[model samples]
Target: MNLELPLAELTALLLASVRAAAWLVVSPPFNSRTIPSALKALLSVAIALPVVPTLVGKVPQLDTAEMVVSLAEQVVLGAALGFLTSLLFSAVQAAGNLIDLFGGFSVAFAFDPLDASGSTGNGVFGRFYNVTAITLLFATGAHQLVLRGFTMSYKALPLDGAMSLHNLQHLLTNGLVEMFMAALQIAGPLIAVLFCADIGLGLLSRVAPALNAFALGFPVKILLTLGGAGLAMTMLPQAVSTVVDKAVTAVMQAIGS
Candidate 1:
């Protein structure tokens, strides 16, 4: 056997793998540093396997400047989709970050390499929320939805579809607004409670200037936060499901669908 057919097949598979792997590089749960590079590469190949057969006659020639431009476009497309997915997913973490802000946990910063951008102290609620969101992503099959949305891009977007700037701007603007809205929805109740606590502490300080209200405020807020966290648990899975669904939609929109 000359291995000629096998070589062409491998080439196609590798090209498809580029898009898949590039997507995972910035998409959450997959983008985590805890997962080894080797594992990510394997996962990329695994995901691309199904797409490879469908890509017949569509692989671009590697010998021209046009091909280089096309490959660059593919990378950009994958990165854009991945980033949009991640932005929505971060809503959960944003809620948690909000909690940290008022819970007096802001000063407890530590390094978390898995976090793409954030201080250590900023993740108190964010870390817990992220872990729960990731769990829900798998348990509720949202991960599958996200992957399907991405895989479907081969048809909806095509290897050579021209990107529309207006569509890209529209998706990004809407996505940012949605992200902050989700964050506030998740964290607002707790923030309101904390605000009440602060007001109460302020009144107490006025009534008893001898007492250290500032010192008492910290423990009281911590207790409230812990309690609020338990109450928030019931809302987490559902909120995560909604966010993941929106992420899939955003990914589709990112590809101009």
Candidate 2:
């Protein structure tokens, strides 16, 4: 079968593909190191095809100056969307870090295989949380919600539409704040339990000066934290769902879709 398109149409398609690939390479679930680059590119192209028709007719004709500007705009837009989607993972990781901190695992560090980056204190927990969230994201079909957000972007911010720096900045700021809030909520229970435990340990030390507080408190706190984490695992699915929903909403709103 012969498949061909006019030069102009081809250029538009290529441009859209570039934008999609840029976003997919950085976004969660799609951007994971485990997913092959070839598969990621293929997925990006598949995503761009449905939206290409709507954009081709409206996007300006390819010219040196216009091409440069449009390409830059597309890259920026893709980055913005990718960054927004990544916040959910960041929130999960942050929660894990908080748990580690309050649980007295601050000195335990581990190399995260998924990120290929070093982590400190509760870094291992953070990485585990992120992986769990990503798994849940796929299981719940939240990835489709992310793709839908991308499609809606076309209507909110067309291919040739002007980029609103003010709006983008606002969205980015709001996303960061929300990420922090989500992390705090997920870690709150563990932190509260640990706090009370610490106070009780301090009182015990004051009461019995002969007792070696460091020797006994360490093991007790570790056990309590592990138990607390086990209990908290029940909430992981709900937290993952909420984070994905918030991320999708943020992306859609960022582009004013």
Candidate 3:
């Protein structure tokens, strides 16, 4: 028995894998440090498998220079798609950061080993929210939906399509706006209470100088934040779902799908 492999399909699969590899390197929860790079590489190839047939016909002639250029394009395209997706999902972590800022927890910054960025300056709530969001993504099977969205990108962008910088810029700007707004929505009520608490403490300080209201402020705000965070956690499942949908939408829009 002899086995035959079509060169065009092989080239297409390799190109598709390159794109998926770049995306996996940048997107979460696949991008988390807990996931080994080797696993990511395998997963990328797996992800590109279904798209291979669609891409085979689109595969351009691959001389050395064209191959290099094509490989670079795939990386950029995949990274841009992943970045847009990540930007939408970052809203949850951003909300936690805002909570930490308002709740006086920012002072206790420590390293989050699970974070892809390997940043050592995240506060307690920020890391908590990020971890929880990732867990929810897997538990609810939203990661599959995210993968489905990426696979759909080939139809819109294709292997030979050139990405539009102007459109990418527009989507990027909108993603940022949406990210900030989403973060505010999640942390807003808590922030408002904290703000009121601050104002009350200021008033109390002015009225009764003998009693250091500022001293009480820390404990009071901490209690409120804890309570608020507990309540806010109940909303995470829904928020994660919404973010997943938004992430998919952002990816499709980025590729003009």
Candidate 4:
């Protein structure tokens, strides 16, 4: 028994799946190793289904250099879009890193088993923020926006669209810049408080040599970090809302423009 789809439909599915698979391979939540490849393939198919009809007319014939080039193009396009989707999450992680740095918890970083990258700053503040941010991501329905953006990207950048690898360097540069700016915006207040704590400790050290201000630095800073951490955590739900709004805009602008 031979079950077969029409060649045109099959081609559309494969190409669309390739793009979807490439995106899932790189993008977060889906990028986690705990997600099985079979599930990923199924999700790819599910995603590809809606977009296949739009690509039917544009399906490039699979032959010679043209096919290879087109395959590469699909992969590149998926990766770029995936990177765009991940930018704001990187900012969240960066904010965590900043909190860790200022709180003197940089020394506490350990190999995170849950981290696919194997390296992560598992500082108290950053880890807590990461957990809460992820919780808010699901609770606020931001994941739906992410999936919407994924599907919407194809309309903005078609399967056969031109992609210049040269632009990749610029994308990365801009993403990093945005990451730092967003991190500062999220963690800037707590960081400033920590800075003021440092200054106060320095002044107190000069006032009483035997007071052991340097010895108090760790506990005082930890207290300060914990004290303001709740306020910073509260900002995350709103930040997640803002980030999701901006993320969709970024996705559209990145692909559409």
Candidate 5:
């Protein structure tokens, strides 16, 4: 028995795998520490195999210098796309962070062992929202859509060409704005209730100083946040769906599709 592999095809597979691996490192759900690096590497290779045929002809000469450059380009391209997806999806967590801030849960912040970023500042609601969003993302099969968008990105950003930096800049700007806007929309009513609670406490404090209404502010706001959290979460499903579409569009637009 004899086995042989074409150099060009092998090179294409390697380059595609580099891109996929970088993406999985930066993208959410996949980026979680719960997934081992070895598994991610194997998954990257699996993802690359299907696209190898399309890329084989376009694979450049088998020069060491060119190969190094191609690898770097793929890493950068994959990380960019992954970051965009992560940014858009973080809106849900941001909404929860806002709730934590207003509800006095910020003081309960603790280290999250599973977070890739190693940030210790995510409060109770922040962590809760992040977990719920990930659950929804998987349950709704939105992760498949996101993965499909990433795989299709090869069509817009081929292995041989450079991505559009200007387009990436524009998308980054718009993505930030959208993230904040979506977060506020999801958490706005709760925030407003918390704000009004503060105002009422302030008034009571002035009108009846002996009653010490200001002391009740913390507990009252906490109860309001807990109660309104259910209402706010009612919007999360639709918000997640909209965010998936936006993330896919951003990835395509960034690559000039």
Candidate 6:
């Protein structure tokens, strides 16, 4: 038995595999630091193999210019999908930052291992909440939904078609705004409580000139912030659930449209 591929067929498969691997490197679950890069590449190749078969005879034979153009398109599609998944995590981090700012922990800074960027001191709870949300995302099969979206994207945005500039602009604008809005919603309750506490402290300081506002306000604010954080934990499940649902919906809409 002999098995050999023609030059044209080989080139097409290679192109498809490269495109798939590029997307996987930047997308979630597969893109995590915890996952080995080699494994992610391997999985991308595995997925691309089947997909390429469907396109092998259908897609045009590649020339140098065409190959370059197609490769660029694939890179854009992959990066966009990966960025969409990452937005959820970004929203979580932004919410944590807001909580820290309002909770009087802005001065307390710590490095987040996941972000590698400096996070707030009050972020311990926020980080824990993020982990829980990510866990639930996987446990509830939301990760599978993401994978399905990626697969469907090939059909919707075939390599031969021109990328839609309008769709790209809409996604960029709406996706970013939605992430920030979600973060604000998650942090709103705690921020409101902290605002009220500041007003109360202001009233107390005016009433008693001799009392050291600095000494009295610090402990009181810390206690109130801690209590608010504890209460916020009770709302985590519902908030996370809503966020994940929205993310999945956005991915589907992006790919489908």
lDDT for 62 (candidate 1):
58
The residue ranges of model 2 lying beyond 4 angstroms of the native Cα positions read 1-5, 110-122
Better of 1 and 3 by TM-score: 3
Better of 5 and 6 by TM-score: 5
Q: Which lDDT values do the candidates have, in the order given?
A: 0.82, 0.79, 0.91, 0.79, 0.89, 0.70
Better of 2 and 6 by lDDT: 2
Model 1 lDDT tens row, 84-198 = 8888888999999899888877655554565545534455787788888898887887889999988888777666565676887788889899999999999999999999999
* Highest TM-score model number: 5
Write one digit per residue (lDDT tens) for candidate 6, span 8-92.
5566566666667776887665666677888887887786777775566545556778778777777777777767766765677
Residue-wise C-alpha lDDT for candidate 5, range 1-257, written one tens digit per residue: 88786888889999999999999999987988889999999989998899998888778778989889999999999999999999999999999999999989876754445554546578888888989888899999999999889998777777897888888888999999999999999999999999989899999999999988977887888789999998888888999999999999998788777
lDDT of 2 by residue, 99-146 (tens): 878876655564445434443335556767878888888888988888
Q: Judged by TM-score relative to the true structure, which candidate is superior, 1 or 6?
A: 1
As a whole number from 0 to 100, the lDDT of residue 172 in candidate 5 is 91
TM-score of each: 0.91, 0.89, 0.93, 0.88, 0.94, 0.81
Q: What C-alpha lDDT does candidate 6 achieve relative to the native structure?
A: 0.70
Model 3 stretches with alpha carbons more than 4 Å out: 1-5, 110-118
Better of 3 and 4 by TM-score: 3
Q: Which candidate order results from sorting by TM-score in descending order? A: 5, 3, 1, 2, 4, 6
- Candidates 1 and 5 compared: the better one by lDDT is 5
Let me know the TM-score candidate 2 reaches against the reference structure.
0.89
- Residue 94 displacement in candidate 6 (angstroms): 1.5
Q: Pick the lDDT winner.
A: 3
Candidate 5's clash total is: 0
Clashing pairs in 3: none
Query: In what order do the candidates fall by lDDT, top score first?
Result: 3, 5, 1, 2, 4, 6
Which regions in candidate 1 have their CA more than 4 angstroms from the true location?
Answer: 6-8, 110-121
> For model 5, which pairs clash?
none
